[model samples]
Target: PPRVRECVGPPLSAMAVQSTPVMLGAAGLCFYAASRTFTSPLVPSAAGAVPTPHLRAGSAAISADAPSTFSGVVPAVGLLAAAAAVAGGRAATSTTMRRAAKVKKKGVRVVEGKEIPWNIFSPKAPYEGKVIANHKHPHTLTEDTGDANWETSHVTFDHGGKVPYIEGQSIGVIAPGPDKKGETPAKIRLYSIASSAVGDNETSKTVSLCVKRVVEVDGKHANREVGEDKPDKAGTHFPDSKVYRGVCSNHICDVNVGDDVLITGPTGAEMLLPEDPEANIIMLATGTG
Candidate 1:
């Protein structure tokens, strides 16, 4: 773990280096803002850890000339420190943004007739014409096979989009549904991107989704129709004949060769892969929650 110990040092030092401006700015701003406002509404901030000052009727002109009597220094100092931390984090983010912009935006070169989205958001290319060609592998149900499902059921998307990704990314499949009420632009569901940049040309851009059908409850599907309709029960969301069944996997499960479907983004940071490639990944999941 010495390497880990070593890894932590520079960043901490950089943060300390970056804190100078932020800490000063915070202290100055707090002092400025409070100076204008009177003590009557000098609200105690939201930490709820401390009580606001109890002031006398005229509080001696409320001057900090008497440093002994002034108690605002503690909160002011804490606020300054928090501001510094935030600024340091922001600086790192800005640096990363610049780097990403500088790197080549990798993408799938369009091969056939279909367009594919390779952005960090939607990773999968929609099945162009109906009847998806190679679906021999629906979704790997390899429960405990010590298998890497990252490359399972992998289908390559035509390059026109970049698949630059880390270990854990979430993408949404843009599955268009019936144009019923409130059902346009399609709904998108987040799927964790399984593959890393393994340099494999074929399946590198492809992402995997581990999902199960959220079927309509028996009572729900069995509900009776309203107005001049059957007395049998039906599911939620009226116009039950059709509805907004999620965008990606649900559509994926039912994909036939060449179905004209839409796909959206890979938007999520929750399960982002660790920056340290040497870091061991420990995933804990309870029934795909």
Candidate 2:
């Protein structure tokens, strides 16, 4: 995971020179790292090199930087060939997003296939506090979870006009801007859903989130105390629980009613539930380390 953490702007000049190629970002096109390793970036800065002449054909989108491992001219020809392959269709230039927003104000038909990128819906938002209606349940109802297990914290939202999702997705909780005692943005984490679309038929679009508190253990011992007793009087019947020594979990655990929090998601992940009626499932998780 640490190896994949990187940035790709402003060319690097701190390493030994090899067959490195500089990468440039185009506003309209999608860009992603190919995960090529053992070697670093292919692009290098041509800070002092003289500018080359610009040339244009009738309808070709010229590439300014040469892709590493290959010569300048191949990518250009490849682009041309790809364009020709999708000449009539929008694949060469357009995506379903265009059909939904720009081209058709009436609305585009849901094609019922293929996955889109996570950034398309733009879930990123700033955390604004909200009031927790319950005395014990600190998490504000981000949406009606529709889970029968939790009626106290349940909430309802007309999610995206209709619920937008695929199974096995998770949501990211962006905790409130650091507590009054601290001065940093709250860390974000993910939670998976445990509900099935059983009675969710007509109107109320809903999703469930496994909401819990944050526990921070800054001291030597990472575990909670061996044993302790606490009482609960919220009438909700959930026990008075102590955080097990985690930073984010601790803060989350202390949430009071009427608190504001930020949430984003229904983002897809690699794990998926089996679709075949006869398929078997095996879940395995190790002990709490």
Candidate 3:
């Protein structure tokens, strides 16, 4: 009998191992062909054909070293483009973070030409502003303990387009003439700003204050001297008392439209509005704060 060989299939793992190398070889050949096609010069239509003198003269000579040069240069160009894209992305991210930091530091949204004014007019050299309007509220309460009939006034001043202020800041009002202490120049009283940066009428030239007349009764007063205080017939300790008005409050409240008043300072930074539009704000105020 002739020698017989048994037919047996190779194991699955062995088949996979054999196929992998073949596939790898095919892939490598394909990659090399693709690279050569990209980086190598165009081949002439006919092989072993000599170029005519006129054709050679008209066309630039192809250098033998050019294909190697292109192979290196193409990868370098691609890498440069990728680097630039990454750098641009990082720069954009950095800029966004810087803007956010600025907003957080300011605590308020920034408005165009609306920064908190510092000493626009100092107490020494106060701005002489004309009272544009002094409107009285119908029912207003004073900060004093007494339930006195006190009035709140919305006093607007025209600074001839010089004074600029934002909301939540304060300005100083110099009460004319001598103080109660007999000082020659009256002291400057700071009042919270009630209007927006653009004044009452949206003009960039004016500012307004909400002032409540300060008044005190005999019972609330610390001093026991010099006031007509009469007890009720029932001998109750509470008594009818006199009302003493504040010099600055009275001056501001009594001011009429077109009257000139001395003003100083557009100060205070703690109450300034934040620059971010989406920021949450909570305000706690009482009695013309």
Candidate 4:
């Protein structure tokens, strides 16, 4: 018989488990308060009861011996409960709206034009342009001090003729060399153009892309202490791993000035700017959009 082994590692930690009880307690309190407010008015109304006297504005020294009825108490409690429910509901709605607003701020909002110019150049056949400049932007004072680094490159491609494009269009960039699978003919990646229609230098013969290098730490092949029972296949000790550089972004960022890059399509129409000059515009962007 073959030996079957059941391998188990460390137990997973649920960070959110601690907050569950607190959240349930608060919800239970709100429910209990609401239920009490609605059901407290169980007393019957007084028959042939005298209407409560309306107090005047400056009437001090009023009757202190006035009878208090159960009917009055019930209505008062009901009114208070209704007011509380309304106020709580409004507060919750306001909180929800604020959260949604914060999420919206993270994404870009654009008023687009009706016309969408499609496929001037396809992926099958792409236009080649010379890279005039490929350089990193000036780092902020705060960013210079931090260990967390983000490299943003401004790449300019010079198209011999005018490649007419709208404000919010994107262009395809083909990385040099084969993919990870050793496939020939590199994949085309679409990046949004940072420059205007007239180009960065106002020459109408060039375009630019604001590219951020995407570096991700691969944990699957991460270094771990070799077990006595399960030794490493290579019998070698590896140190803590480094991040894997993105293929397309690395190629774009590393391109020197005067290098020719494959370009395709002044594409996308959904983000084009509205023609109306006086229109209210709200643009939300993060790290160069």
Candidate 5:
């Protein structure tokens, strides 16, 4: 990456004898080289000329003290083109960032006078809920689960009436232990609550989540060390790729009847049901909304 300067060439006065067409062609090449090579155009000093860069790697830079003649115009035009290119690129980038910043979060709906339970348990303080039921949904069931195309589960947890949530709200699930980065208490993953405030058992003491086991190839952890674990386990290996299982979703799906899970928040007010009984509701969702 070290810049190697070439020896200084002859004065532009001597080159002025060249044909006008030849001088113009050289000026065009100069413009293209300057625009492609540098973000800041090279400026000729009051007493000296601009550096004419050679396109190839390690090619020496030639300096010419451009006189007040036709030959002097080559480097001058190139300098202007380079500066314009850099300025235009920066302006486009600024416009893109401004457009992205304009996007806003969805507004929370207020139906006359309905109280919204927003963040009863936060990420800082989470609720411990026990698993009441974890079963495969009938829609995702296959004759041979070993080669099942897709696996989705309906997992219910016992909140002990402490964590109350309305229908259409979501709860955050924190996977047990240090994550792949060795950070203790992995980050929370939110899933929509599939049950109403009274719950599936109608006791108002439980909450449920619909989760799909996520299995896919991940190139991010390709260089990570995979343990000598079974293929059915988390770090399943492939011949030329790395297969990853979802940390939180897999944990929730694999949990047994009595396993305790860290739960946070009956959060999100945007999806709350309108209080009006006769209000028309049209829901359209895919996968696990």
Candidate 6:
């Protein structure tokens, strides 16, 4: 049978192009030294000897008539070059991705001599705040508009001297489990802090939020018959989707003085007060903002 020669030049060259400089240098040196040994007059190739198919690393094939010393060296060098090429390729890809993507700031940051916390309590691990006070504001509406009138409440939560917050910062409220889609521990809702650093009662062990109960009729069920509405096992009636309640806002507004609420972070720095005591700030707000 006639001897067959296989070439792996294309794939190996592509790999070399994608590999890092160190890997390319190492592979080049190995091949260069091996080429010198193969071309030397001192080495001889046995012609007409029974050809034995030999496969080396990187899918390269070498003639079996080559000297035994060179045969062993080729595969060893091939393995080293192949390994280096793979590792260098991966490293190059990773570096390119990092260079092209923007990295988010991590860890704590200091501002105005005060250390600010970032992601201290994430959604996965939120802090438990106790409802200390939940009261409806009497001056929310002055008109005779019944359901149309705004219903706002000032709610306070006891942090037990654990959660420290400044004015303009916001706390994320995670409503109780099993949402409409049966998803446990519903999504988080961020509400602005309504109190200063000293808190509503002048103590730092608490945080407060001004929330307005969201009540809107869903147009989807507006065409349904009046008698079609039914009540769940909890005795809560679904009246033609009559009331689409805001999960977090309604939960906080309806809480008693001892219920526990899931809280995440006292985050936000854009609206922080200036360090100067005489900064003279202007006040402008509307609705439950």
By TM-score, who's the top model here? 6
Root-mean-square deviation of candidate 3: 21.7
Please tell me which model should have the higher lDDT, number 4 or number 5: 5
Give one digit per residue, the lDDT tens place, for model 2 in 38-130: 123333347665544433222222235634423433565466445544542433234345445565222122223444224223335532434
Residue-by-residue lDDT tens digits, candidate 5, 138-233? 322323355321567677899998888788788999997466666567799999998789988888999888787765555454322345223432
Query: What is every candidate's alpha-carbon RMSD to the true fold?
Result: 21.4, 21.2, 21.7, 19.7, 19.7, 12.9
lDDT accuracy of residue 14 in candidate 5: 40
The per-residue C-alpha lDDT of model 1 at residue 140 equals 34
For residue 98, what is the lDDT in candidate 5? 75
lDDT by candidate, in order shown: 0.45, 0.38, 0.63, 0.59, 0.65, 0.66
Query: Considering lDDT, which of the candidate structures 3 and 4 is the better prediction for this target?
Result: 3
Off by over 4 Å in 4: 1-117, 134-149, 220-242, 286-289
Ordered list by TM-score, greatest first: 6, 5, 3, 4, 1, 2
Candidate 4: tens digits of C-alpha lDDT, residues 72-173: 556655665666566566655665687686773211333342444445666787888898853333211122222212556677889875356778889888
Model 6 alpha-carbon drift over 4 Å, by segment: 1-107, 112-114, 134-144, 218-241
lDDT of 6 by residue, 95-164 (tens): 6687576554453556676777655677998999898853433323223245521467677888887777
Which pairs of residues have clashing backbones in candidate 3? 107-274, 108-273, 108-274, 108-275, 109-274, 109-275, 109-276, 110-275
Clashes of 5: 0
Name model 2 segments beyond 4 Å from true. 1-113, 116-123, 126-163, 177-183, 197-204, 211-218, 221-247, 250-259, 287-289
Query: What range of 10 consecutive residues in model 5 has the weakest lDDT sum?
Result: 134-143
- After TM-score superposition, the amount by which residue 75's alpha carbon in candidate 2 deviates from its true location, in angstroms, is 35
Candidate 4, residue 224: Cα displacement in angstroms equals 18
Native-to-model Cα distance after best TM-score fit, residue 28 in candidate 2, in Å: 38
